[model samples]
Target: MTQDAQKDSSTYWKKSRVELRAAGFDPDRTAKTTAVVTIASAWTNAHRCNNRVRGIADLLVELLAERGGQGLVVGAPAVSDALTQGTPTAGYSLVSRDVVADCFEIGHYAHHGDAMIVISGCDKTGAAALMPLARTNAFGLVLYPGTSSPGKVSFEPWAAKGTNLTIMDYAEGRAAQEAGRISAAELVELERNVMPGSGTCGAMFTANTMSTTAEAIGMMLPRGASHPADYDAASDIHADVRAQARASVEALYRLMEAGIRPRDIMTLRAFENAITTVYAMGGSTNMYLHLLAIARAAEVPLTIERIQEIGERVPLISNLQPHGPYAMTSLHAIGGVPVVMKELLRAGLLHGDVMTVTGRTLAENLAATPTLEEIGKQDIVRPVGQPVAPANNHISVLRGNIAPESCVLKLSGKTLEKGEFRGTARVFDSEADTMKAIRAGEIKPGTVIVVRNVGPVGGPGMPEMVMLTIQLQGRGLGEDVALITDGRFSGVSHGILIGHISPEAARGGPIAAVRDGDTIVIDPGQRTLNVDLSDAEIAKRMAEWRAPDPAGRLRPGSVHDKYVRLVSSAHYGCVV
Candidate 1:
């Protein structure tokens, strides 16, 4: 090893020793075993969260320990148990930042052993755990709890149960209404019929997208991307977890033997590859920010522009979630993320030479796992030469007076108007306000919905305001309504939703200057978001706008606030 590598290894080992001691372990006498840390979202309240945490824990304890010299350490058993029991614990306490911090803490404690495995399958938790794992550069593997299959599980029970029926309910209700007068009981039953079993929603939400992206990036084993809860495959969840943990350890040992650094496994190219998959899968908009955070942790420069540039060439292929008709279970049955990677590689969209945890080039991994005919027939993954959309259709970075640092928009399935639009800017400072306006019929069709104060530094975490788009659609103005936000949208979000407007209102982005009835135009075909105002008008407004006091931000005086401050102060990709 080079002198610097040797020093780095030594420092890491020392840090591990310190952490282990702090965690109530005897550094000198503790068994030299790999430690696997699993982070799950609060379980009981969210069925998918419960199953994922339980499934991963069950898998790790069984698999790694059987490998002879490995020990499993779950980061938050109390939290896991609470989630499984369905009891409300602390609110907002189980955020992704906490999970990531735990992973780092546990990984450091266990670094002296052999390797680390991360088992997570929630939106923030998955991203958080993986980010720190990348930084540890420890031999790491991720086990994603799969989504439940729609065919096998019955949503009837939940539908029969109760709650505020969403747009889907309304859609079904409309059908019912058209047929005849339906009782309240009938409507409740119908809603439950559509949301069966105990799993995360099948759409391409943050959890599912992160899992698929993890597999695409090589942090997960081939064909490890999806397993529906109702399928026999879900029954083997433990086996899957164990296999992943074992493979992770082996991969780590191979890297150590080859004198490969963590950077070798997690590289700039790999980050780009993962981000591209995130776009293609119609993954989470959170990924745009999460990718930036992960890249920072790995000491890579990943900007909004870089992500948009990559998206320009990578088409949205996964016919899942908010953009398409299928769910994650269908994607898994159709060959999962490996198939996606294979196609991307074939299309020359992904860098085939990138190193993976599997100890093989990406090309080799795909070749070894040919898509089964049954799965291929389902079209889970688009063929390399014939993709769902041409390369780079899923995401775009936009720049205008509104977003100086660059903003992002997912372009897949989006129909843009050829001519410029001049409409009054209907500004809503928060998602709640926007929704209230929509429901109250105050928002007219062809309105520019400016959702401000929800950027990275603004929302604090830049939460996706997906409901705004859904509400707009419900109002029969899906195409006519344009959403301009400093926040983001879910991967399932489509149709003229512009997100990640940088230099957010809190930081004086042009979006902050937009008032109700100000003329705003969006020309996606030309890649422009112009407000009909002169430079002087914009400058004067900029001067007059007062940024919100930092104290007013969400999660104020919390760890999230601290993270925001830390990341904003550090290099762009250093959060991990």
Candidate 2:
């Protein structure tokens, strides 16, 4: 071994001995100190992109050493080797887990002997890492790859000049089939212009929402969740992350010394913190599912009703798209999640005593950090009592005859038409078909555009189709067009459309029973979605209507199946 490696090994062994002694181990028993096992798992896809996961592992191992412990890095063989090569100076044993869960199980078992640090990113990998940590009640910290780097693209031109084109304009196919057809590359360029930054896509998509939620819930360090992967600041941030890992291990040791258990801190307050953050951020509807799954994994009884009750009171505050005008960077500039949490506290919306991954009380941490106003102009981060709205405004649960199990809608204001809207239903089975017809000028005013099979189990992933609804605003009848779907709309696509019409078509919801020409009426004032037909007639139609099989040729299963299965088993709002 090289001199540096030899020094690291000796240092780690000495530190391990010190820690064991401090933990009250007999001097003789210290020689048999349990081996700390670190699970450094990365998503298969993220691993292919760059050395993001490997870097996280390297930093974690360094942190473990600083905390006076040794660990073994375990992951897929390829990722394990990459991490081993990158952190050669770190004196940690290397191991491999046959599967992602195997890593957690082995890590949990190792906790009997040693502590653990989990370095993970991406969707599935994050979930996998969290599961075993929760089960083992292990001391762990997650190192996300952060956001993507901003490329050499600029949105200044688009900002300076207005195209007068909306999502509706594209849906109408006016841009797609027009004589002036923009190439796919041009479309990509346009998107790049709008998304000019180095944080995961900048939209309120799944990845961004998950990261933001993670920060809000105190899983990752404040501001630790927003750095772009390729930013020059990444290396320094990586060092900070290493320090956090050391702190985490030290925290676990302190708790064990004091007879405090992980369960003592992982309370309902944490879930409440998560809920408040989700609402304030205008987070992904999928968060509803993810939160539910997380609660289940943690053995917490988080029900849809509890979530809705919280949602009803937590006002949307984050001004990020596809809800508001800003992006993650802008939010971070305005003090990021800390500002939001402070606002929640001031508003009496959050539990101040909630324990965070940092091993400090939420309030204590906030007091130690810079004030929200100091990070940005005061106006950027809204004050608590004087909110952007009275309470959480984006997500609401609705129940009526059409939706017996309950449905969700992104409500912006109380300005929905009070009485029933009697309109001829123009049904489209797919988003593509609906867009095609809209582009062809086939849809007319006073039309309720009913899109079916886009529900949780139907769309499988319940893909956001609100982009199409937003596009409709550019058409002459944008104001007059009302969209109703079994799927969901973007939180930003408020006011123009109604989504999350539950009991999706695949499950034979009332929405599937409506005929193309039937008059459909939605009375938000009364919380109702009704057809002109009598109940008997509706029941007869429902009996005759055939639900579409996702397994059918039209929508055959593939990788999308993972998302579909997640949705199918997901409890109401819970994403599996």
**Number of the top candidate by lDDT?**
1
Report the error of model 1 at residue 553, Å. 5.1
To one decimal, what is the Cα RMSD in angstroms of model 2 from the true structure? 9.5
Instruction: Please write out the lDDT profile of model 1 over residues 1-576, one tens digit for every residue.
Output: 333443244334434767768977566543444333222222333444446556555555555455533344545422321132111222122245445546554644544424455665555555665675666565566666655444221244223323212223434343343334455665555554444544444567666777776777777777666655443323444444455555665665565556554467678788788877777777766676667766666677777667767877777777664655566766665566777776677667888888777778888888865654435465556664565666645556666777666666565645454544556788887777776787677877778889888665666555566656656654566678788887766554666777877667766778887788888876655667778877888899888888777764545678566656643411132242
Say which candidate scores most in TM-score. Answer: 1
TM-score of 2: 0.73
Clashing pairs in 2: 167-471, 168-471, 168-472, 172-439, 289-574, 289-575, 314-392, 315-391, 315-392, 322-492
lDDT of 2 at 205: 43
The 10 consecutive residues of candidate 1 with the worst lDDT sum are 81-90
**CA error at residue 551 for candidate 2, angstroms:** 4.8
Determine which window of 10 residues in candidate 2 has minimal summed lDDT. Answer: 89-98
Cα-based lDDT for every prediction: 0.60, 0.55
